[model samples]
Target: MLDVGSGTGALTRVLRAEAAGDVVAVDADPKLLDHVEGPTVVGDAFRLPFPEDTFDLVICQALLINLPEPVDALREFARVSRDGVAVIEPDNGSVTVDSTVGGESALAGQAREHYLAGVDTDVTLGSDAESILADAGLDSIEVTRYDHDRTISPPYDEADVESARRKASGDGLATDRETMLDGGLTADGYDSLRQRWRQMGRDVIEQMAERTYERTETVPFYVAVGQV
Candidate 1:
């Protein structure tokens, strides 16, 4: 099995432990390749550094959303794999957030709009990967959905601790300017958005201090499969 874009080898580690194969991790970042447990290669998704029909399975997780043309990457995967190709990607548009705070969900919705608008890639093509595979000229295509739930409530964890620190300094909110601009937001629009995000983060901090805020965020992901 070949794992492309194997950043930090997160999925590569899983495949190595669970699957019976010679798991190979490939990524453009040499720093990330250093952490991979098995064989590692430096490669790009658009043009994998392997001969045609080299591996029985080629896969990637959270890879397609960052790509400008996901099907093009999948075509390369198909070219390198002798038997199968798979992609695990998320549908950012399908995300749902339930919160006890009044405006947090609304604020999140606004931020999401800006993010999707500003980003160059199609970041929400999770369930649509099957169609993308079909377009890539692969046969026996299949897709499966996985809904992930990440909730924040009482007895917060380390991630919550980090969130609290960021809110105190408005760290995360301050970084939105460039992302919004890249996503096509005007300067005035980004200024408005940055203020709103900061206000929302402040409100979250206050609510958390009072031990009254609770949130449940669910993100939908899809596993697209195809035969080469």
Candidate 2:
């Protein structure tokens, strides 16, 4: 088995534990590959260094969402794997957020719209992986959906307190402003969005001060597998 873009070897470790074979971790970052157990290779997803059909399976997680050319990586994965290829990615467009704080949910929705519109990469490709795999000339394509539930509730922990503190600082809003700008948002548009985001963040912090802040998020991920 081969794990491409195996940052910190998270997926590689899982494959090592569940499967009965050596899992080779391939990453462009040598610092990350240094910690990976068993064999590790420094390689790019665009051009894997190994020969054709070098591994029985090739897998990646949370990689395609950030890549400019996901299909190119898929084609390379197919080229390296004799049996199958799998990619796990998130559907940022389908994310759902529920918050007890007033205005927080609406704010999240607005942010998501701008994010989907401005981002250069196909952030929604998790749901479209099947079609992408088919385009890559793979056969017996399969798609599996997984929903990750993240909840923030009462009796706040240290992390929650720190998170609320950070929200009050508007750091998240600042980061979003930068991302939106990089994604082609105009200066005036970013100012408008930032105003709303900061307002919502302040409201959230106020709710946290009253010990009433609670939120949950559902992020959908898809695993697309195909035979080479």
Candidate 3:
């Protein structure tokens, strides 16, 4: 099995333990590859350093969106795999962040939009994973949809909000920390958007837990599998 762009061996660890054959984890980030336990290699996704048909199965998660040339990377995966390949990626186009105040603060909204836009390359073909595999000459293509949702309770303090704010700022989504804090909706605004998300999270959790909140917040993903 081949785990491409296996960050921190999150999936690689599992594959290493479960698969009978060897699991080779590859990634461009040497830092992430350093801690991986299994047979690991640091390499570019576009140009994998492996012989043709070297793997029976190849699995890629949250990778396509980050690659500058996803199609080329897909072709490489297909080239390396002799039997099959599986890909999992988030559907950014379908991503929605609910807020109690109808919508998030303008800054928060812009930040979210920027975050999504920043990874456009990764998700450009998000909705077309199967098509990608087919175009690469893989057969028996099948696509499955998965949705994951999580909610946090009580621990929702100012720190948590601040942490999220920091992450958003650091991620280059927001222009600056102050803008987010000030609720100015500028790249620099740094006002707490926590209350808004907290309320939204609570509503979602209640609805999901009590079965009364018919509306659900979900993150959709696509899993495409095919035989080479």
Candidate 4:
């Protein structure tokens, strides 16, 4: 099996544990691949280094949406897979976020809207994977929907604390300022939103101090598989 775009080997570790044969992970960043335990290759998705029909299955998770040309990447994946190709990608448009903090969800939606608008790639392309595979000339396409639910509540961990701190500092939103601006959000509008976002973050911090803070986010992921 070939795992394309296997950053940090998260999925690679899982595949290695279950697969009957070898699992070779390939990524563009050697720094991320350095963490993987077994065979790893530094390569691009569109131009995989492997020869034709090298693996029984070629798969990627949360990768295609970031690419400028997903169809071309799928075609490349098909070139190396003797049997099939699969992609696990999320539908960002369908994501649901809830928080006990006042106005958090609304503010998050606004931020997401701007980010999506400015983002160059299709972040919500999970549902279109089937058709994309078909367009790439792959047959026997199949898709499965899965919901990834994340909840944060009592007994906050270090990571949760760090997230709250970043929010309170408005650092997270600040990072996306350029993207939001490019997405058509006016400077004044962004300032106003950032002010409110900081307030929401403060509220979140207060609630956390009382151990009452809670948040839930659900992202829908699609597992699209096709025969080469």
Candidate 5:
């Protein structure tokens, strides 16, 4: 199995335990490679280093959208795997929050726009795993949807808040000028944002904990598996 963009080897570790064959994990980040236990290589996904038809399966998670050229990357994945490829990515089209309590600040709005652009790709490709695999020439594709929820509470740390902020304030996605500080969400503004974010978080948690906001489409995870 070839695990492309295997960050921190999380998926790699899981696959290692589940699959009997050798697992070769690859990523561009050297720091992430350091934590991996088995065979690991630092390389680009667009241009994989291995020879053609080197593995029985190639698996990727949360990787396609990040690439500059997703189609090319898909073709590369096809080139390396002889038998099949399994891909798992967030269904960006399914991304939604019940409310924008803060009235969509520039940073936040931009975040949404950035996400929309990438999601457009997913939408164009059917916004599911089946489309991605089929488009990449994989056959007998199967897609599975999973509900993934993340709840944030008080004592909210900067890292957690920032990650959420970044996701909300997608890369150059927002058009508003005021919310964005010189084109980016600065470290300083994060604390103030956190206070506001915490209020929203607490509201949702309280409402949901009280069984008020039921079955809200806040987060969703999707998986697609198929043969090459």
Candidate 6:
């Protein structure tokens, strides 16, 4: 099995543990591939460095959503895999957030809408993987959905603390300033939104400090498998 875009070997480790045969980790970054325990290769997803029919199965996680030409990349995956190919991608458009703090969910949704509109790639491609696989000329395609739920509650961790701080500073929105602007958000609109976002972050911090903060986020991921 070949794991494409195996960044930091998180999925690679899981594959190695569960698979019957060997799992080869491949990525564009050599530094990330170095973290894998077994065989690793530095390869691009658009052009896998392997001959046709090289592996029984090829898989990728959270990859297709970031690519502008996902079908082209799937064709490449098909070229290398003799048997089947699987891709796990998230539907960012369908994500949902629930927070005890007032206005957090609305502000997050507003930001996400702008971000999705600004991004070049199809960030919501997970929901359309079936048709994409068909376009790649793969058959026997099957797709399954998985919801990743993230919750924050009483026992706050360091990561949670940092998240609050980032929100309070409006760092998260600032990071995507260019994208948001490109998505048609005016400078004044962005400034107003950021100001509200920062206030919401402060509210989150206060809630956390009082041990009354509660939030839940759900992101749906689709696992599409197709015969090559």
Root-mean-square deviation of every model: 1.7, 1.9, 6.3, 0.7, 6.7, 0.8
Q: lDDT by residue for model 3 over 1-228, one digit each (tens)? A: 999999899889887778798999999888998889858998888888999999999899889877777767888988888889899887766665443323434434555554554443656466889888888778899998887664434445565454444443443333433433443344322234443444444444444344443322456788999898
Cα lDDT computed for each candidate against the true fold:
0.85, 0.86, 0.68, 0.94, 0.66, 0.94
Better of 3 and 6 by TM-score: 6
TM-score of 3: 0.71
Compared to the true structure, candidate 6 yields what TM-score? 0.98
In model 1, what are the clashing residue pairs, if there are any? 118-183
lDDT of 2 by residue, 37-78 (tens): 769999999999999999999999999998899998899999
Native-referenced Cα lDDT, model 6: 0.94
TM-score of 4: 0.98
Per-prediction TM-score to the true structure, in the order listed: 0.92, 0.91, 0.71, 0.98, 0.66, 0.98
Residues 1-228 of candidate 6: C-alpha lDDT, one tens digit per residue: 999999999998998888899899999999987778779998999999999999999999998888889999999999999999999999999999999999999999999999998999999999998999999999999999999999999899999999999999999889999999999999999999999999999999999999999999999999999998
Residue 92 of model 3 has an lDDT of 68
User: What's each prediction's clash count?
Assistant: 1, 0, 19, 0, 5, 0
Stretches off by above 4 angstroms in model 6 are none
Instruction: After superposing candidate 2 on the true structure, give the runs of residues whose Cα lies further than 4 Å from its correct spot.
Output: 182-184
Q: What are the runs in model 3 whose C-alpha is more than 4 Å off?
A: 99-102, 105-110, 114-124, 156-217
- Better structure of 2 and 3 per lDDT: 2
Quote the RMSD, in angstroms, for model 3: 6.3
By the lDDT metric, which is better: model 2 or model 4? Answer: 4
lDDT (10s digit) by residue, model 4, range 1-228: 999999999999999998889999999999999899769999999999999999999999999999999999999999999999999999998888989987998899999999899999999999898898999999999999999999999999998988898888899899999999999999999999999988888999999999999999999999999999
Give the poorly placed runs of model 4, Cα more than 4 Å off: none
